[model samples]
Target: MNRRTFILGGLGTLGVLAGGGVLFTQRPEFGRLPRGERLARLEASPHYVNGKFQNLVPVQVMNDQNGENRFVAMAKFLFGDKSHLSPKQVMLSKKTDLQTLNPAEDVVVWLGHSSFFMQLGGYRILIDPVFSPYASPLFFINKAFPGSNVYTAEEMPKIDVLAISHDHWDHLDYPTIMALKPKVKQIVCPLGVGEYFESWGFAREKLHEEDWETEIKLADDLSVHVLPSQHFSGRFLTPNPTLWCGFAFVTPQRKVYYTGDGGYGEHFKAIGQKFGGFDMMLGENGQYNMAWHAIHMLPEETAQAAEDAGAKQLLPAHGGKFALSRHPWQEPYRELTKASRDKNYKLVTPEIGQLAYIDGQKNEQFGPWWENME
Candidate 1:
């Protein structure tokens, strides 16, 4: 089979059947995990309960809260409210070249969706980058909005650290990871997430799979803290076998929080208390639905989460690239802007590929670039 076809079927590590059964084939393309010593370690982890990882707090998936599918409710959430679901024209964005930027300058480039390229303390960091046209098991579904997929891996500089929150296809593209592996020096992710990277030919030594609240010191001035989040993980069928989380990027120069993808929870307030405060928070503000409200937060909740996290500035993420849910493509920015009213935090709304100066996180310099566009 072709590589795409292999990815669709031979989900060796994460491929799940429509039923609850998980497909654990020996197909090398599927990227196996937990072999030999790794399996022994996984069996001993306290978080790995009943053959899968359990969240600190139980989370409801796309199905009904009881784990049963109510077809009427599911159908409405998925298919209803098609109006203004996406823009008619390609979204315009600023052109950015990472190789041309000054390494000493701390800045961040939002490459659509949850993808971010950040330069801090002479280190280049990438988080949850998916530069593909479609985010799906098949070729046709979840096609990204026009023009949002312009930032390719070729445009990226040598990555000092690649941070992955989970292994979902939308956040972890097979082809994109393959393209980026050579340039990436270190990989940071939730525990068990590096198994996929190791299977994909990454050196074991370069992979740093961290548990919640654990810290990885990068340089004399920089460190990363893996923090807890309320989210589930699975590429295909084996649910929660791997962990999902957010992260706190700590440097002598700045403190940044990245909420990779998750619903609103008290953990936001707790994370803030632990970190003291964040200069900026990269928040998930899209791809939400009431049916699966326990996994993704609504726009107002996204605003509140930033406030709860004690972020001085809110960087809207997980939107403007793909319509993973039924909401209008621009709804996230619109609602987040409104919800932020009278709130303490400043909203940082940069277009895709626009630069977010680390120093500017505290300044109200960015405008609503999403306004008056398609």
Candidate 2:
């Protein structure tokens, strides 16, 4: 080929690549970064340093144990055995008509993964809601198990408070947030996560973006406390621009906690003491591996964390929906059942969309639903 012709072809290819990059960045799913006053607030936070949020204890997102780097871990997860990574048979679930429920009842409906629909203190609240069929940016990746995604944004009643734990795609879904924006009366998220909501046209007055140890009153009877989690946050290349956290909902009569994706840490005990003791603990109990043990907890740790938090009941989250790890689909349930045998807390395993009472523990019997499934 002539030199002039080769140069022209190379330039054309570069132009196309540049155009594609621009389009990719423009997608609404990418969300918006913190800027202007939001960026200033983040910078002032004690947790925010060197342009990123820091965990209470230093944590490695991917720990290199036994000479295994992140690439080796990824390769094993993608091309390894995976014989039991996904269930061969459809999982079991029960659908509850959320709008038809009595407003005076205090209950929790598991919506799969880290998503939940909870009515506490006579106010409806949603936590880390990912209603989309998949958890990742691409539809084909991290797809939810069959019969697991039974609830959608349309099925949810008007939300009194929408609480987001972080900015990861699984916890803060773009499409789901957009669909539920009209029904959400208020939004509570960790520092800097509100940038995404403001960019999507949610009113700034509705956002209660806060830092760790801060409390926001949602109603006269209910208050939401932003707590700590040993986890990292990021949607794309940059990590920790937004903070990751847990939530403790305190009413006049009861207190409940949600441990948003975190590994074993002493913060659990600290939070437990601060709140006295929780009535129930919604712990992240799946998608864990030794390679990333610094970020995600094993099933045994999930139980121990609840114990440290002085919880009487523990409901597992971050599983029963998408397969994001290499373990068997039902391993978390089996392991947690064994782990909770000697612990002080009772293990609560409810099917997707099934109601689990948060108030006095009536109708708390949930069978091992993950069993008998392929």
Candidate 3:
């Protein structure tokens, strides 16, 4: 072959090899795979069927005119000239340990984002426990904050229930579940999420899947009622193959609402009517935008959600840990605080690893510690 032709051929071969390497490294199989057929069948079952879209009854939220501008400015400030943003820096106080939690009382400790350690009536329940650093499909691509996870899987107490809101990677970590399986008693999940756990070696009998608006009694005076949420679900390309909803936990002492991951909807009022009133309502207050308003609620909508659920006080979650959207990391809190002040809603902004005790009549404030991080 001529010298020029040989050089061109060699360059082409190198380019092909480079492309192949990139594809192989980024493939989904390198991460967690979808559930198997047995699990898929269960997830696809009609018992967990969600009604038509009309049944959800979506609520309208007023747009923030300057939201986009603020988002761009904050993005530039935090991630200047970078294509991807790094995780925020966080400092954790070791005042209360998750391992030393009392299983007989009503208490909650924030692990990060939507993950929480909740103890009620001698039962320990964990909600959406994401211990991994990143919330992405590829672990190496995204990163979590350094020294953030206060309690590792090994440090968790004997868990009576592991409750999942959906199958999002940020909410469901495969490695964390495998490590926690030995100590977990039973997993209570929305419609299709149990399939993911069962494929990861969790026993079928240990998995309890509940449909929307269904109620199950876990123990004496401790019951879980699945409520409607305006959210979609999927771990793969198939959307809504499973279901997603919030949960209401009722105890003899007090009632608490965990608004899993949802946007604003009228179902909140129905939930309030069905369950009476709650001492505390944990609602989503982060990573929202006008582009996807139907799927995630803005701070104002979160306040409205609290009112609709008949909660005396509100605990804003789904923020303060991971930077999921374009808004400033602290925007959710700022907006929520303002909305609460204007609307006269009682809101609690808890710090990472802080505890909140709920007694029937009195309300208390925990941590605005996230303010220090700003």
Candidate 4:
């Protein structure tokens, strides 16, 4: 071979090796959990053996049409000179004394995005906690709020339960989980997600896997029911390696529904029928676009979802943390407020770290918090 040809071929081979190294090392080894005994117990379930409901599908790329789905143009329209858009601000709550938060009653605090802290029946549960600065694989490229995390890991109380709705990076953060492992007593998650915790050093015994429609009694008065969500999941290139579902927290004082992240579907009606009525429904209201309508619901659909779930009050989530969609940061709130006004549904828009008491008749209004920041 000529010297120049040989040099070019060698360079190509090196490039290939470099690309493979980045792909393998950057991605977490999610399936390396101790599989023998755990797989035995998991295989006993019919869903596991048949792969009836759990399967990973390849993601399809779409052709961009005009400005219809161009994220850059949409972002420019929402925030002039995208680079000039202000960073998100974190609202720190006044120090919460656990003694003051009565566990005999019901209380909720929204920590931006879909993360929430709830106290009921003497149990403290955190749902989909993402305390990391960025949700993207490349941390520096994606920015979070400038201040400290709204709530630090050290500040958290000894948690009774940590419930995960899915395996999306924004919903399940690796840094936060490692920090919280020592303090968390048990983790209740859907089918494939428990494997992630097992690989991350959480005791296998502490992880409980529940399929759709299964109920686990946490305490005499507190129970969690895994309900269907019209959604898919994946952290790597492959999608939906496991199942995705919402959670219903049934306490003696109230019924709270955490609609993790889902599109509008008939399942909401089924949940209403099974659980009767919910005191408050926390549903996703942001990170939506026309291209992925079937995967993420629009603002109007969120209000409709609240009604379908038979919720007396609605609290929109999945916004105010990261810029996951083309819409302006405040667009969801603006549209949802109008929808709530037209439909006569009570909407709760809490500031970051604001406490919301479920039993109280007077609900607090925090913002348009995302508005002024922009």
lDDT of each: 0.83, 0.91, 0.73, 0.75
lDDT of 4 by residue, 1-374 (tens): 99999999999999999998767655663333325665555566544435323422222222244655556645544555444322545443433554467666678888778888888667899999888888755665345655425777767888998999988878888888888888999888987788888778788778877888899787798799987787777776554556688999997778999998877878888899999979888889998866666668899999988988888888889987676666777789889988887564578887777777776575666556555565
> Pick by lDDT: which candidate is best?
2
TM per candidate comes to: 0.88, 0.96, 0.80, 0.84
lDDT for model 1, on a 0 to 1 scale?
A: 0.83
lDDT tens per residue, model 2, 178-238:
9998999999999999999999999999999999999998778989999999999888878
Q: Mind sharing the TM-score for model 3?
A: 0.80
lDDT of 4 at 355: 75
lDDT of 2 at 145: 84
User: If both were scored by lDDT, which would come out higher, candidate 2 or candidate 4?
Assistant: 2
Q: Superposing all C-alpha atoms, what RMSD in Å does each candidate have to the true structure? A: 6.5, 1.7, 5.2, 4.2
Which predicted model would earn the best TM-score?
Answer: 2
- Please give, for residues 217-285, the per-residue lDDT of candidate 1 as tens digits: 877888988888778888765778788889899888789999988888999999989888888899999
**Pairs clashing within candidate 3:** none
Q: List runs of model 1 lying over 4 Å from the truth.
A: 1-29, 63-83, 361-364
RMSD of 2: 1.7
lDDT ranking, high to low: 2, 1, 4, 3
Q: What overall lDDT, based on C-alpha atoms, would model 3 receive against the true structure? A: 0.73
Q: How accurate locally is residue 163 in candidate 2, as Cα lDDT from 0 to 100?
A: 97
The true-versus-predicted C-alpha distance at residue 236 of model 1, in Å, is 0.8
